[model samples]
Target: VTFLCLPPVSFLLLPHALALWACTRSCPSRCTCTQEKSCSVLCDRINMADLPKEFPCEASSINLDKNNLKFLSERAFGTLPSLKSLSLDHNNISFITPGAFKGLPNLVELKMAHNEYIRYLHTRTFTSLKRLVRLDLSDCNLFSMPDRIFIEQTALKELLCFQNNFRRVPGAIRGMENLTHVYLERNRIEAVAYNSLLGLTSLKYLNLQENRINVIHDEAFKDLQQLENFYLNDNLLAELPKQAFKGLSRLKMLNLGGNLLTNVSKTWFSDLVELEVLYLDRNQLCFIEEGAFENLTSLITLHLNSNNLTALPFSVFQPIYFIGRLYLFRNPWECDCSLEWLKEWMENYKLVRDIPCASPSSVAGLDLSEVVYARLNGTCVDPAELNLTTALPDNPTTENKFNILISKLLQQELKEDLVNSTESFRNGTLLDPAESQVSGGYNGFSTGRALLVLLSMYLIQAETGPH
Candidate 1:
């Protein structure tokens, strides 16, 4: 026999060429096949009305998304023991027989999202996919699932079920201990009852935003000890139980924006010591009790903008040591003596946004930084002239007395600095209006005086009550 001469690259590609030729011969009509580490078939958007009757046995992945397939018969994909991934998203599939996915033992991912006609599924639909790690069934108009639907998928890790008609969290997810992420946003969920999420110990992220959730049981999330990120924004929550978030110690970020909360209670977050970012914006909050965030020592960013707050007591945020970003804009701030501590605090915490005055028309619309002591109707007492020792009661506590003296000393120095700055501004020695608005304006200020007046009004309130 004549010896065939071939290059080294051709020799290496010979096996792949033979595999591709075999896959092409077995590939069904209107489909393409290629040889990678394994065979992959692309039959997406083919306008097919049924699953292809023939597929290469060696095919490890298939994409049939955006097709007209409306029904899935039993054993739809016949005994593809090597199939690892399948995408049937954006199809018109409305019915799935019990054993439709019976032969996909090694399949790790199954995406059938956007099949809006599918509202119910048989309990044994996915019973054979024991090794499936990710499942996407979102936008299927599903209202509920059988209690034992996911009882066998112990290896499932992520579940995406957003934009559905579910009235509550599916009870089928109660025992998914290996699940790490769940997306249930934009659903019709009305409440989160206790034990609704009973045994998901490995969960790290949960999204329930844009739901109708108005109530959360006290221990609803007590089992999620490892959860780190939670989103509950744009809900109808008017209030939460005091112990609603009791056991979530590792949570780092919480979003409660766009809710109906009228006040914030201190007990709601007493155990969240590792929390770093908090979003409480766009609510109906008019009051926040003292020490509301005392346990959040690691808090870094806080959002209190777009609320109904007229004034906030300074003690609510005194415990957060690492706070860096504070958003306090778009609220009805009453610029009075009780708000003097806020002005003093914002002067040092330069990362704070501009807080405009809403009452006492003289300072209305003016930033808190621009409102001088003289404009507060002379309500704030000059610390240099006030006697701290005489202001105290007959038998004052040591902590109270120490805090009063420190507040007096701080106010005295701040008053003197303000007087000198005002005099310089009048004498044309300070920066111009444009320069001041850019350099030492509301967005930019010096540090080191943030804690100066932290406990001033709080301690005073304890002795003399609100100013």
Candidate 2:
């Protein structure tokens, strides 16, 4: 071996060169990189407080979910033009600066959901993502959207903003020309104002379910000419004006369940000519006008369960020639001679179940559908003699007014009776004396009579059930 002594400067330089090699090799910290020949990174649930400085250069999809990110700066995603999908869900992000996603020109899908602190927004935060297609901001605690958060996003097709505090539909989305799906469900939206959905001609799916909506203007959906599925269920709507759903001629599925509706007036479904599946369950509906569903000839399934309906005129469902499924359970159905026509109509469909009757204690819980009309002891009126038409004149006659007044008076009396009985039972004041009449102040009626009235009143509440 030949003697080969290096200079003193080489020893000091050797340590510095070794330090540089370790720095370059430590770029994949706090994240797992997995790609055979392509570039992609998944940095999920690593408790990252900030974006990794040395991410994959040519990465396309970056998943940084379940982190503790508080803010997304403009330079968060550094100059990655090939990035296509980025998911930053379950973060505590409260703010996003302008051009936050400026470097991601080719980004297609961006999901920032479950960020409970991201309530307020700036208009230009997402303006740089022109090529983005699907954007999900669900469960963000947002009260309202910015004026132009989605400006110039012509290629955007879907925008999901569900489970927020939005009081109404975001007006900024009216400019998007090619969007096909928009989900705003489980918000605090109060009403659907006219022109709120205007300029969304290409919108096919619009879901506004589980909101606080109490009103829907007749022209609210006028601009959605191409809309197909409309979900307005689980809202606070009490009553809707005639033709409240106009201009959605192409609408197919309509969900108005879980509302406070009390009546279905004529022409209610007159505009939904091509409607197929209609859900009106879990409401307080008691009356439905004739021809209410005459225009829904293309309907396939109809759900009217969990309501307060007494009797539905056959004319209401007469035009629905090809219904596939019809659910009428959990209602206070008055199964009398009035349901004779329904017996024949129900047999036409095989999916119909045994409907339960809530009236006529003799057949109270019995299945009205399975009742053998031929073997029954009761004499049913002739089908032609049983008039099913119920006139609802705007200007009722004096006699009609008197009848209404009497009906209200009777309801008040029944209410008072129930209250008195409940109070007597609660206070233990109910009579227990074995009394004999012919005295100065004889006990009114017998104990048996009192017990009978109380039993009947209690049954009424049990039959109606809870709201």
Candidate 2, residues 1-467: lDDT per residue as tens digits? 11143223465575444333333343458776555434567788989998877666667678889999998888678887777899999999999998788888889999999999997888888867889999999999899987677776889999999999999888978757688999999999999888678788899999999999998887787778889999999999998867787777899999999999988877678888899999999999898888788888789999999999888777666777788988999999877667767777777656677689776554676777655442112355321111222322455544553454344344444455475663223244433323323221344344444554565555555556766
Error of 2 at 435 (Å): 29
Computed on alpha carbons, the lDDT of every model, listed in order, comes to 0.83, 0.76
Report the poorest 10 consecutive residues by lDDT, candidate 2: 382-391
Q: Estimate each model's TM-score.
A: 0.78, 0.74
Candidate 2 error regions (>4 Å): 1-27, 36-38, 374-467
The alpha-carbon root-mean-square deviation between model 2 and the true structure, to one decimal in Å, is: 14.4
- The C-alpha local distance difference test score for the whole of candidate 2 amounts to 0.76
For model 1, the run of ten residues with the poorest summed lDDT: 382-391
lDDT of 1: 0.83
